[model samples]
Target chain A: MFDISFENAKLFKDCVDAIVNLINEGEFEISSEGITLRAMDPSQIAMVDFKMPKKACSSYKVEGDVKIGVNFEDLSRVMGRARPEESLNLKLKDSRLEMTFKGKFTRRFNLPLLDIGGTVPKEPKIEFDANIKLNASVLKDSLKDASLVSSHVVLSIDKNSFVIEATGDRGDVLIETKKEETVVIAHECTNNAKAMFPLEYLNDILKGADSSTVITLYLKTDAPLKVEYPVGQAEIVYYLAPRIENV
Target chain B: MFDISFENAKLFKDCVDAIVNLINEGEFEISSEGITLRAMDPSQIAMVDFKMPKKACSSYKVEGDVKIGVNFEDLSRVMGRARPEESLNLKLKDSRLEMTFKGKFTRRFNLPLLDIGGTVPKEPKIEFDANIKLNASVLKDSLKDASLVSSHVVLSIDKNSFVIEATGDRGDVLIETKKEETVVIAHECTNNAKAMFPLEYLNDILKGADSSTVITLYLKTDAPLKVEYPVGQAEIVYYLAPRIENV
Candidate 1:
């Protein structure tokens, strides 16, 4: 048996939002440490890793480690109803997950658990050649600009600057950010690296991030891209495979 | 030749938004008085009367009265791009409307005139039995609440209160505001008035009104409803034919 409560629903709502776009259903592991989820998209092009430590919760109780499978879409819809200041409570009862929000009034929702059978996928190991930390809005706006011209964008990094470029029948969009710009919080590059990725996946990956939030990115030549950002006290990480040229 | 400019684009944009929902295309009359439009919806169930006074424009010039036909959908789309602080300039050039937004940058669009041939509809004369002025949001929210249960709502006004009621397979919704309530700024009833109106049209009619704006309503038993609201310095009026209770 496990029961948990959060001071506010924002953290949990954001966590579900970060995963729902990529994974339809996922297994959430609850233990004394807290709640954690790792799942890959149906197309296997993207994966998300989420962690919320026990310290972040207002109250946490558990008899032993247990795994609960849930449909992210349904969970997202329920969570979306929570007001910003409302507290959220979760409990396992009769093999169903019961959620309650406490504010001016109490609201409860019961969601049935699914018997989803699948082993957790292993995280990819890659030695990135460059890393950069920048304001999330810069990346979000660049992706939107690229979408007007092409379905994919090429992210490149060198010693002097980071650039996003997209070319299509309509036109081409190129956004270059120099290391001196305040939007680029940090930059390090031992070797120049570039890779092209689908714009739709990248857009969904950043949906949960606030414009002011700082996001760290890892890139390499013809390798997957790694993105890490904070959702309140929780941490969310995403890995998206690059679209190799002519492949 | 006719030329006009507004200190900001908000007023003109709002005027277009108020008319676009009910009338797809309309002929605008431009003269020394400014601009005016009178058109009926395709179903002939609703009519819109809009007027923008010359005093509201920063500059106004006219040689004589001219009627220009336009597609409201296209006009609305272009006006939607204007920022609140951008100044708007409009002129008749080569039988087309030339619209330019000036701010830090200058953006212009040339919309070809259409020959939308239709005589302006005459406004109906009705001696309303009851009249009330209330906060726009109160009416807007009541319509939305009623829509959850039925496609149409009954608006009733008696000596002491104004009520909106809707009943359907799902459930029923009833919202009553007493004359003493702050939401009801003014209320008068020589005779009880009640009429049924379609929710979709009512919803669209109130789309352009700000929550704080005060809207005046005139109603009578089994008669059409009349509503008037202000879009900045401009005035917008709408008349909606009621759905007769029984054939």
Candidate 2:
């Protein structure tokens, strides 16, 4: 039996919601180190890698390495029905998923297990060129406005400004913030990278990222974008494939 | 030039929201007698009929019948964004729909005429039996629970109790409140007459219905349910088709 417990079930639910919107399902690997999950979309357009350390759990136990198949969408829905103040208790039974939330009335909901006949990919190793920390709410607002204009958004970072731009047949949206804002732009080798990615993919993946939470982004030229947001004691990493601009 | 004004944009928005959700995409006919619309779903499973008398309008000016094809969904979305305290103005300009909301700043949004390419049915003449007054919030809450079990909910009103029961493959949900606590049941017959209707249709038509506001329901055995909810000087009526149940 493998189990990890958290005081707040809502926080875990929030993290699952953001990642599930990007990927359909995942294979969670239980180990002595921690619980780790890494997978990409069917078309390899977007990726999600997550790690929940032992510290996040009040009680952690793992007897052997086990691969548990989980449908995040279903899990998120069940988690969403829980109250914010409820202390979350999760346990895996014979074939059903059970949750006990502590609130006005302790309630339990059961969800049937899904047998998605497929194998998830392992986490990829990529060298990043730039690492930057930015405020979560600012980035969310910029992306929301840009999405109204185009399906794909372009993020171009330079030494002094963090710029987000999107243009389509209908209209165009541009957002730029200076160093004084949450934007801390740095150029090591005068490298200016512009990557275009699907706005919906980014939006879905960032749903779990709280407005007050700071997000650290690892960027590279012509490669997938890596975004990491802390969820309780867990770290959720989302990688999005960039759309090649033919110009 | 045609114009209508409301102090709160959200008030109008809530009313329209209930209407659009009840009826499918269809054209509405505006006449000197006041704005009137009636239509049945494509499958003819449900019918939505609405009318506002000329006296109810702030200003009624219609020399001839004007058929305006306003996409209720699109119109509802624009209206849904309106702030609650803002003064709202709706007007028709040539072939366009215009809405102006005043808050800290006056904002205007345009709605292009839609070519839904459909017809609105003439109002049907049907006699309804058993009309009862109810608290809107109590009805809303009861329906909310019933929807969790099945889309087709059976609503029964007897001399002493009003019951809503929905049983599906998932589970069974029953909400029964007696005249002693929740409602004052009135009837011509003491026997039980149950009719089933789509939950979403009922959910939509409850917009103008407030907690303390009284709602008049006209019902019969296997006949469409009629709900009348008042908004300011206007009263909107919704008739929903019923689903035939085996049990």
Candidate 3:
């Protein structure tokens, strides 16, 4: 038997929302310590690593370590109905997952579990040259600004500032946040790093992050970008492959 | 030369938004008293009469009475850029309308006037049996509820209550606000009145009214419906022809 409950449903809902854009289905591993999910997008261009510690839940119980496959789309639809003031409970029953929301009125929904078949991809090991922590809104706004001119943006970091620039037929957009700005919480660099990434994937990766969230980004020249942020007590990390420009 | 300024751009923006959905282009008759526009939708089933008294403007100046044609789409686009704290200024420059927003920074846009050639249609005269004044949110919520089940809804009024009901293959939805309810501020009915109306048009008509605004509705057995509401110091009225049902 497995059961879990949350004092506020927003945490669980937000966790699912973070990855729903990159993947439609995922396998969640539940253990005595916590829950974790590692999945790669269908295009194999990005991978998501999600972790929810047992302490995040008000109550958690497990008989044994188990993995359950769920359709993210359907889960998102159910989570969308949760109100901020409501508590949520989840129980595994035979072949279905029973979800209950408690507040002024009790609402229940039963979703069928799927038998997913696939091996989880291993996280890549990389040595980063620079790490920057900044407000999520800064990144979100810069991505939107870049999208106006091009489909991809070049993210570069130096000792002085972090810059996002894009150029196209219409015009060019450049957003530079200097190290002295309050929006840049922390900045460090051993060597200057620059890489080009698809704006669409970056937008989807940032969708789950709130504007106030402080996000840490690890960067290296011509390598996948690592982003880490916290949702409630949970931690979510994403690695996006860089686009190579052919001269 | 004509010049007008608003302390808050929201009033002018909302006024344009109210009619942008119904008509694409309209002719504004500007005079010392105020500005007025009367136009019919492409289908000619609904007519909108919009009036903004000179008192609503912070400053109003005009050399003489003038009629200028404007594309609602372009005006809406420009108005949308106005921030809440910004003040809006309008001036007639030759064949173009110059809009300037003054706030933390100044931004200007020039929209060319169109030669709109259609004559304004006269408002229809009708005798109604009932007049009800209720909160705008009540009507907006009722229309949304009816849209779930059917494309058309029956609005009826009697001495006791105001009812909106719709039925379709999926199911039926009925929302009733009684005379004692705080939502209904005033109710008067000499004879029972009922009429069927297309939900799409009703939704468009209510889109401009804020939830806190009180709206007055005049209804008849099988006649055009008249709705009146206020936006800032401006008053907007709409007349919609009821759909006659065949037995």
Go through the candidates in order and give each one's DockQ.
0.04, 0.04, 0.04
Q: How much lDDT does each candidate structure score?
A: 0.90, 0.71, 0.88
Candidate 2, A162-186: lDDT as tens digits: 6789998889999886655635433
Q: Model 3: how far is B237 from its true place, Å?
A: 0.7
Candidate 3: residue A15 lDDT (0-100) = 97
Each model's interface RMSD (Å)?
Answer: 8.6, 7.0, 7.9
> Against the true structure, whose lDDT is highest?
1
| Candidate 1 per-residue C-alpha lDDT over B1-247 given as tens digits, one digit per residue, 9 for 90 to 100 | 8889999998899999999989998999998898999999889999999999999999999889989999888788767767769898989988878787775434556677889876899989999999999889989988989999999999999999999999999999999999999888999999999999999999889988989989999999999999999999999999999999766
Model 1 vs. true fold: TM = 0.55
Candidate 2 segments whose C-alpha is farther than 4 A from its true place: A61-63, A170-173, A180-190, B1-247
Better of 1 and 2 by lDDT: 1
Q: Sort the predicted structures by DockQ, highest score first.
A: 2, 3, 1
Residue A201 miss distance in model 1 (angstroms) = 14
- The segments of candidate 3 whose C-alpha lies over 4 angstroms from its true place after superposition are A1-247
lDDT of 2 at A103: 51
